[model samples]
Target: MKEKQIKQFEEALAQKLYKLDTEKHARAIGEAAYIDEETFISPDFFLYARCLVVVQGKEFYEYVV
Candidate 1:
């Protein structure tokens, strides 16, 4: 993705993740960040995760792990 696209993705992902209050999802994201600093730290994962959130809503929690 272009730098602009990547930046947009990161902003959107941060917004979505910021809305999450669940400990499990928060911790899982944190662990993923630790395991793969490059991927998790970037917002690319947001593209996939945003789709899941749009499709699954609250059930998205089940797939977080």
Candidate 2:
């Protein structure tokens, strides 16, 4: 796919997911930034965790922003 086409697709998808409150949706068990106990996961893993970080970018975009 071309760059512009990819950008368009991303914009469209981002809007559909924009309404979600990721923090509330995600399960939080440990303090972010620094932790010793429990394993920390990407916020995108709230519902489905992907083995690859790139595939999980949607969650990262939704939460980290």
Candidate 3:
């Protein structure tokens, strides 16, 4: 992604998280993988690389919970 686009996405992420109730909200690993050329293998080899999924939408919430 371009620098401008990444900045925009981060801003939006912050905005969305700001409206949540801390007592009921939390963060977790969404998806994770290193995308460098050294790993032409797959996107699952890298562990602990969190994607930071938000607890939103019925389907996504159920998947995480």
Candidate 4:
């Protein structure tokens, strides 16, 4: 794909990923991972958690995130 097309696709995919995220889903994984409340509050941790969710693939993401 062209660079512009790739950017558009990435933006769309990011939207889908964000739409899949919910407070309940975030809290569930944080609890499961034993992540401290303080650390969980960090924006970086949230982004990392989201990446982890997507990397697990569609079925797992649907099941957990």
Which model scores highest in lDDT?
A: 4
Local accuracy of candidate 4 as per-residue lDDT tens digits, 1-65:
89999999899769757965666555665444434466535556666787787778889777764
Better of 1 and 2 by TM-score: 1
Better model by lDDT, 1 or 2?
1
Question: Local error of candidate 4 at 39, Å?
Answer: 9.4
For candidate 4, the per-residue lDDT at 6 reads: 98
Each candidate's lDDT (Cα)?
A: 0.53, 0.48, 0.41, 0.68
RMSD (Å) per prediction: 8.7, 8.5, 10.9, 3.6
Off by over 4 Å in 3: 21-65
Candidate 3, poorest ten consecutive residues by summed lDDT: 41-50
Ranking by lDDT: 4, 1, 2, 3
Candidate 3 residues 1-65, lDDT tens each?
A: 99999999899656644543222332222232233455442333222121333435546534543
**Candidate 3 residue 23 C-alpha distance from true site, Å:** 6.0
Where model 2 places Cα greater than 4 Å from the true spot, the runs are: 22-42, 47-65
Question: lDDT at 13 for candidate 4?
Answer: 67
Instruction: Give one digit per residue, the lDDT tens place, for model 2 in 1-65.
Output: 99999999888765645544345433332344223237565555433322232246767754544
